[model samples]
Target: MLKLNKIFIFTGCLLVILSIELLLAQKQTKTYRNYHFVYDTADSVYVKKLAAKIKKQLHQIEFFFNYKPKSIITIIITRSDAEYTSYRGKIMPEWSQALALTREKIILLKIENADDIIRSPEILLHELVHIFFDDRITTHKIPVWLHEGIAQYLSGYELTVNDRIHLANALTSNNIISLTAMDSLFTFGQVKARLAYIEALTAIQFIVKNHGVAALQMLINN
Candidate 1:
């Protein structure tokens, strides 16, 4: 009887050890090594790269605001055009924007996922300007034009005669949406309309570059 009892106890201990080993193996399998990421599968490298860039940019912005920014901004990056159009169109009726962070530390997915474009720091910086000033503004009365134009301008996207002609055509042809009504002009059709968008972004670029992002903070405050 004593021998049988000892055998039973030893068998039970072995089983428990095996179970723990299995659980540890499972836990190890579940762990993901990459940091600053939520998505599975590596289809888009640009998303990963841009996320790092955005983090670096935020350090400068926090200094600009003179506040210790405490927030974990999460961005879900998607490459599907249909997904892009649906999200962007639903929010503000446009789809070509590269980056946007709403008032709540929630940035809508950056849409420009093209490898070449995503690599451009200027485009991300343009959106960062909006993120910085938008968060600083307590009230929500600023014209939509301010955000969009500032984004376009600071992004370093150029404007020329060809873009002007396209925008003029959009306006004269009535293809462009009403300037007063366009809450955010991310997806204007005519080339000229886009040029106008570039111009708006540049205005932001100008303000920050010359007057300062602080000026934008004041603009939003007032």
Candidate 2:
């Protein structure tokens, strides 16, 4: 029975790999300016509609950073949750909707439904910020709070009133997490993670409010 179970597991894994390969083979490519989008053939119409918006957002980001990436940015938009999880032979966190592979100049987005498709531009802008910021500085490792904070800020993630309430409540209750602990917050439960994001955004907001935009660029430089 143990041997049979092992066989079953192996076969399942093999099938998953084959399925992903088939999906990749069936992917359609669409190029818009510096961006190259790779998505399932069925998503072609959606991707085509999204490309112009993505281009506009990319230009805004480039202007904000005053830097343009020389290499093409490859974006892979996965059509379903299963394909999204199975691609690259690695499973991402369930809460993660998108990711930026900084060095590889690639962004992977999971589009599970119409809402996700509508939100794709915002998601893409966030990941693009990550890539662009990483491209600016090569030597030092950016702190998680600062990294996430900057990305959120540049991508125009506004803090809701509830977010402010949650943050204030945490602060008053002495449940506030340290900046050092922010790195591990992503692996924690959703409630904590949400708080962490709020904290990070607030931190960046404070910095920008007091120090000015030049301070952010200086921080990126050194």
Candidate 3:
């Protein structure tokens, strides 16, 4: 009986050790301020490179919104599109560089290589805005335009010449999308999605210009 009990104890300990090792291998974490990031060991260099930029952006965002995250935000950085899609559990649009699950306080980023990470520096900032807006604001009934607009605006996304040209073409062709229809813009193809983003940014600019920042802030506050 004593020998059998010793064997069971040894087996349990070995199983526990294996489980811990597996969990550790799957999730290596890096903490900066209120943001807690989980990524693979191989991507440590990439995460470190963006840490300073992310921290600075976070400060600016917090100051702009007058809000700090109440809890540590978990950001998961995936190594490939396949991994990202698996984590998201859906096929995202080509234009979707990153995503935020506001209620869950999670952000997912797909970084395939150094160039890919450097090419879209604003991607994480844009997602951060979504997390901040949803968490900081008290209302849940906000429009998609407002949500996306704020994210783009705060992320320093400006309508480029190409964007304006696209907008002009859209206007001339009578293909301009209405605010109501813009809610499903992400589901559209790449060209249409780009146009939708341009339109949204312009709408936000219009609101800020005509009503002043305070007025738009008041609207969002409620």
Candidate 4:
């Protein structure tokens, strides 16, 4: 009877240890000033580098906007596409690489490969810009085109050769979409969505060239 009791105690202790290890292995997090990076243990090196880049970007963004977020921003690095989709459930588009939940102050990134490591800085900065806009404009009155445009512009998004070809084709075909029509761009099909993004970026460039960055910032503030 005593031997059986000892066996039960040993099993219970083993389960407790396994539970603690499982919790420890689930996710790892590091805090850098206002940003908190959460990623898997396997991504420690990549995430460290990514976090440093993001911190620099955050400084630049804050300096440009002259605004800083009130709370610590949580950046979650998803291990797989499936993990990313799971966060947004059925509504998440398959083409989405990153998402900024501004209200929650959380950014979710789908980091699947070494190439993703190269692209991480740009994507992270893009989402951080979104968060900056959200923090400053709480009324949620900003138009979608302006929101995406400002984010893209400040994040240094450039028109690739393919993007230019797409835009040229769109213009020649008289299929150029107006900025207003892009309010629901994400819900559109992939081809249309890509064109809408290009249109938005061009519109922002025009605004900055003509009206100036101050004017654009004023528009955001007001």
Candidate 5:
């Protein structure tokens, strides 16, 4: 009789715990402007701010792409590196702060703390640029380098001083990489990935400088 009572108490506690977890999980989701954002209850304010920023960025992306993606987008915000890695699985690089699965229209972002919130806008915009390009351009013939270049360029990602230094060193050493070599940039480790991104950004900048934005747009349209 005493043993039965103990077992029942343990089972009741277990059920209560599961119910609480389910409620918490349900509270994490919020929808805004066709975007479904998921984050912890503690991040409610952060998610609201992010959703507002996304709405503004969406206009910027539409202006650049000349089209808006009509599909619903999902943004998952992870609070730690471990959570981000777990959500992304093996396909994510250790250095990646965010990832956009364009096919699925999902963006996964890792935010360490409140301090990291400032970086979220650019990261979110960058991923949205990828999604916009993928949706606007139906052809699979677009090169990976060009795809990433467009995303970085449209997201307002400029080359930093460190990127300039890397480019200078690569140029001086005659070790500059071709666009084709950058096709697998994300697969490479951190150092190589950074260089590849800088190179791709510069490539798009060069095109814009030499041929102008119209030329770039024409190429994209074709």
Candidate 6:
């Protein structure tokens, strides 16, 4: 009888523990956040103004892709100088912030300010461009330039003054890179590190402006 009682106690304890584990698992699943998409209260007015501009810029790009105008976007807007410096790299405004993650999802950090030229609509569209062709970026043996360039082009952000200055220097000095070379140097500090960002943006601009958005979409579909 004592032995039987011990077995019952042990079984009860096991069941209780299992129940707790199940509850925790359910909570985690419920709380699994995807991306942070919200605006800063301080930048509300600026955000609205830029949003309109961005919408105008993206009109053509969206038409080309057949994307609904109301597509959802996820991004994190940073307000603090420390936050901006940390995320954007300890260098210059030419960077503003960076993009990290796969297509179908994107993480935009604080390099571009709410009051800056990034334009709200443009940022979202830029990230979508990354997501749109994310799969091709995976299989097409496409390089980083294609990834960044496409995003920059479709999004229609005029290069910031700082960015253009850097670009000018790089181009005049014959320091520009081709698609193949950009692939190798993208994540690495190939030629002044951030130079890859400019090259990618310029190249994408060239493709879309000359060949049309269909050329880019075909590459992704292929």
What is the C-alpha local distance difference test score of each model?
0.51, 0.80, 0.76, 0.79, 0.78, 0.56
Clash pairs, candidate 2, are none
* Candidate 6 residue runs with Cα over 4 Å from true position: 1-37, 68-72, 84-96, 103-106, 111-124, 135-141, 159-174, 184-186, 189-191, 208-210
lDDT per residue (tens digit) for residues 1-222 in model 4: 879966765664455334333443478898877888878888888887877766666676888889877799888888788777666443435677888777567787888887887888888888889888877888758888888888888877788899999999999999998878887776788888888888888888999999988888888878
TM-score of each: 0.55, 0.83, 0.81, 0.84, 0.82, 0.58
lDDT of 1 by residue, 139-170 (tens): 66667777566555444556667766766676
Worst 10 residues of 5 by lDDT: 15-24
Runs of candidate 3 with Cα error greater than 4 angstroms are 1-25, 91-95, 113-115
**Candidates ranked, most accurate by TM-score first:** 4, 2, 5, 3, 6, 1
Best-matching candidate per TM-score = 4
**Candidate 4: which stretches are off by over 4 Å?**
1-25
Quote model 2's TM-score: 0.83
Please write out the lDDT profile of model 3 over residues 28-141, one tens digit for every residue: 899987888888888787788778766666677788788998898778887788766655544346667776767667777888886768844578888889888888776467
Candidate 5 — which residues are off by over 4 angstroms?
1-27
C-alpha-based local distance difference test score of model 4: 0.79
Q: Candidates sorted by lDDT, descending order?
A: 2, 4, 5, 3, 6, 1
| Candidate 2: worst-modelled 10 consecutive residues by lDDT | 85-94
lDDT at residue 13 of model 5 (Cα atoms): 46
Q: After TM-score superposition, what is the CA distance of residue 109 in candidate 3 from its true location, in Å?
A: 0.6
Residues 111-183 of candidate 2: C-alpha lDDT, one tens digit per residue: 9888998888878888999999888878888888888888888877789899999999999999998888997
Q: How many residue pairs clash in each candidate?
A: 11, 0, 0, 0, 0, 4
